[model samples]
Target: MVSIGLKGLRHLDQKPTLSKANRNSFTNEYWKGVRVKFIIQAAAGGISFMLLFLACSCYLYGSLYKSHQRYHNFRILAVDYDGGVIGKALSAAYEELKRPEFPTLYFHSPEDFPTPSDVYQIVRNGHYWGAIYSTKGASDRLEAGIQGGQAATVYNPNDALYWVWNQQYYTTFAQSVVEASIEQLVSAARAAYTKINGTQAFPYVAQSDPDAVQAFLNPIAATVANVEVDAQDSVFLFTSISMVMPVLQQFFFLLALNGVSREHQLYSKMSVRSSMIIRGVAGLLYTFGAALTQAGYYWAFRDGWKVDGNQFVLTWMVLWLLMHTHFTYLDAISAITPISRMPFAVLTWIFLNISTTISPLELQPGFYYWGICLPASNAYSVLVTIWSGGGDNRLYRALPIMFAWWIVGNLLSMAAHLRACHLAYKFDKEQQNNKGDGESAMGMTPVGSEVTIRPHSTNESAAHDDLQQDKTLEEQDLEQRQIYGPSIPPPFA
Candidate 1:
């Protein structure tokens, strides 16, 4: 056994371990040069990456956080067709409820009574959270009901219905507040009428009683309906996840593209097909990994695993394909214009995060609403439809937009890659021709003619020496490929 152990030790000594080989590579003079180049490249890339990361982080987190903090900054439109005591009372009630310090709804009354179609258009445009319509007979109807011991018809859809543009996120909170305020206003009006007339507007009765007086005193009612958009459950969680998921996905894609681009630059002699295959494989892995991670996160925290299996699977597949196509485009962009990676990354981050995924697209200005058609925005719509159930039509609509992005991004990326490869090949061939010409001239000089050695004047020699130094600097530059690589031009240059 000791002899065998000694032989094993000798064999181990003869064979270099991976760590030893790595250590030697680091210390080796040729590898030291490579290491230095790598560090320089890494440093340049790192600084640009850090700048872009900080910008994206600041914009995303800062804007989202601030919006959350200031969620109360919403305006509501109130139309008083009643033009009577009760109309003024309801408007005053809403006005009184407005508190600047908290999330409060500000109610604005138009100078003239707006038609129902006008109200709908205004709300649809998302200028206000909702609009309240009070009919001319609202006060008279309540008074007649109170006097005749009958239920008041206060919330007629033709007269006094509150049409709320129900978005799942901001509208829920705003709706609750509006409903509560209307109830309070009605109660106060009933109490005032009773005090002046010396009688109770509503008197409690047995369980079997129709409770006409109670209805009269609390006549204000609301019908909450979603229009042009679907209501979402768990609004806060859904919105937060929508923002975070895209940021994480884009970050992973940037890393994958950057790595693949560096690999291509270092192995410039790699066949184009092989390089594309490697990038495609890397993008696939990244997309799959990111999709799994996002899905797992949703499952663990958002009860996604308990969701309908088919819907969950479909959502996951959609997310995966979206990321795969997006990353593939990024990989091609990296290959074509590596220096533009940072700018493109920042632009994409802004587009995904600032778009309508986390909020109502209608709430944004008209110009920004166009961004709702972007792939990220459409993806969020599909995600919400799948997660919350229903809205098959929305999912269907979003599908075409997603497909368009996938197709367009891939096509543009491929074209750019082909162009870049052609340029690189042309550059390489020109370099080879220049080198061959220099070699041929040197070889033919002695064979074709007697070579004369000429002595230069001091000024001429100085100029020649300077030219030699410039040539050495150019050679050194050619040896060191900057982070942009030889093929890619510097950004904005």
Candidate 2:
């Protein structure tokens, strides 16, 4: 409440009002400062964008640059049980093709693996990318067939070369690169075999047994079996950088979470821990819905692109964990990173994480080896395993990394949230203190002719003059009410 003596009340009606020109004496100076600041900010923005472009190029392109140079990282085991010509030829053929860009085939004796099932286990267990094996008596069967007798009628050509690989492990890569390379390998091996046997078999090539004739012609018919068929070309989008799209969408979710908290002053009203918990719980719930939506796309698009799933529940769980990993980490970033700079931070994070997942770790440079530890890469590994029906089964390996990201992101976010809360509480207290000071000062400070103003952002001192003016009329009304009866409020009015 403002109190005014009779003398002050009489003079209040006579107070002077400043003209528009006089109201802001330094308008030119303020506008000039704004213009200068705008120019500086514009220059800074251009430079920042240029830097971001350069930095993100390295993040996005690092793995892709000379990607094939590291392809020897894919290990293939070559085992020969036949211990004969075709096996020797295939081994030699594989060696001839063993460039740095191609998967290297390590030759192993039949003694190393008890049976073909052992090779299958090696492939399935992902100890190696694939295996080339000649079954027992492969050369013997082909030899008997070539000789042309009773053996010629019943001889099987497929018994020669068998390729054990799970195309489901990386369908696109297998089809485009691995399969093509395998075809070349088989062709070369066949040619090598024909060169050696063509002269010997030509005289006996007149055999009437069609099965044996076919076997003699193409003795090594390499058959590749997909341990689990994952031929879907559409999974590329879900496997690559596109997979992180939904994760990137969480920036807006974070913005919305912040908008409400800021507008409603939710953080200011609650204890620090409670406010952060609300944010976490809200983010988790939102991520749950997002995960379901992603999983639904995986299901809904099955017929269109096909990643057949009885794995819906597991898919949803993976998506939930994956998206939440992004959310919690981004939330922590936003806690420290200003909203204006968050786009850069987000872009950099997305590019960095997605780069690690673009190709097989072997195809990427060693510098990117550690990137597999990134949450997005780990999430992708797990998702691919799920999509392939556990083909490349990196589940146990990737889960721990994803969990580690969650733990670190939450811990960092909690610390940042506490700091932010402390600052907010401190600011609120300062505002309350300043408000009390302003109210106290006004009661003693002379107004109108003797008033003084100071420009301080947090202090409300500049508004004291306007506040005093508003109180003038209220003070007059109070004086009249005290002096007159309620019915005879004013003299004639």
Candidate 3:
């Protein structure tokens, strides 16, 4: 049956010149159908693309809207251990400070955080975005050093105020908001100290106690300790492209796979299950290599970066999982989506993923919280953690999120493949049924149906074959006539 169908379609594989009558008939009878097909396709494609892109564009645009205004959502702990003149001045200044965009500081007593080092631990632990703490006896040490007249050795002004934050969390926010607020706190303390010491014998202190004068002027200098600093400058490139590179690779592979499948007629030639399995395996293999190559590239250019073997493996594993998740999801979506609309899907995927990572969720509006659930967010969280040595340690939670996405994506792809197989089977069955019915109407034998398809008698079969031969010859002659014109047909004869 397949051989017969191919033989019948052989002529359609070749281009033939059109006669005047054939052209008129095609223009009158078939052209309208073709035009209507294109029209419906254009309208549907345009409308759907516009709606999806507009919604996605709005989502990405709105994701970070008024981000600076949401700065107060970030919490920074303030521990005033210096319960003397400096601490009192800092406390009063902290109260009077009012910057709407600045993070609201939560002040705690020195008793809450016994040692100044505890502030670094809490900040690195992700308890708060940052911490502003003063050391014990910051004021007393300064006062004693001032009175002794040779107290420069005992008094380190930078030790008076310490701001602890992790730059690895989000460098922009860490520097702009968290550090900015810390600077303001330090400035407030400075103003308050000058107010307290204005009446003192400044000339006497300046001459006899040069150290005290220096301490008095710069009493509340800040000691910034960025616990989770980036490993190297190249790390910025490594993490920034983490989302884009995988997605681009996935898109390119899917497109290439689709093109190959269409050219080879894989879907029509192979069973649906077999083809889908091949595609799935191919995607996994490609992602594996891609992940390895990407990891190798980073390793090659580490530029003094270092990590344990386990961490290195985990980084590669995260990349593999992330790429796999992206591939399976795209494969499933592409199975149902038209090729023309795929560009829009890819763009939407990339933009939505980047919108979440470009800034921290705490800085963005609440609606962007779902961004954390996305694969890019989790994968990036794990990657940055690996690169920065130790960040918020979201790996405990992010790894599982990526794994879940990979599992769900594979399931969806499998289901879509099954649906495709079912649809293909139905289409083949309908074509066979229609062929049997048409042949029966022509009083000829029909092969392929188990029941109700009439087979012609011997005489009827012979007559039908002769008639088909005659029709074939007639078509050949007509096509030649159309190509060469009636007057030039002598050459063929």
Compute the lDDT of residue 281 as modeled in candidate 2. Answer: 93
For model 3, where is the 10-residue window of minimal lDDT?
Answer: 483-492
Decreasing TM-score order of the candidates: 2, 3, 1
* Model 1 worst lDDT run, 10 consecutive residues: 481-490
Model 3, residue 68: displacement in angstroms?
A: 1.6
lDDT of 2 by residue, 69-138 (tens): 7677788888889888888878778777889888888889878898888898878777888888887888
Tell me the deviation in Å of residue 374 in model 2. 1.0
Q: Estimate each model's TM-score.
A: 0.52, 0.80, 0.75
For model 1, what is the C-alpha lDDT against the true structure? 0.54
Q: Report the Cα lDDT for residue 476, model 2.
A: 40
| Candidate 1 off by > 4 Å | 1-237, 247-254, 257-261, 264-268, 303-306, 336-348, 351-353, 423-493
Q: Estimate the overall C-alpha local distance difference test score of candidate 3.
A: 0.73
Query: Model 2: how far is 455 from its true place, Å?
Result: 20
Residue range 1-493, candidate 1, lDDT tens digits = 2243655765754454523654565667868668988999999888977877776566445434434334345555667766655566555555554454233444445454456566656655445555566665766665555544433323232233444553432434444543444445444443443444324334432223334444444545444434434333454665555455644565456654544464445234567777556655766777787777676666656432236567757767877866766665554555455454546554655455454565554334344556667667777667755653443236557888888878887777656556555655655565666555554433334466876544447445645554453435455334323332323332333
How many residue pairs clash in model 1? 0
Best by TM-score: 2
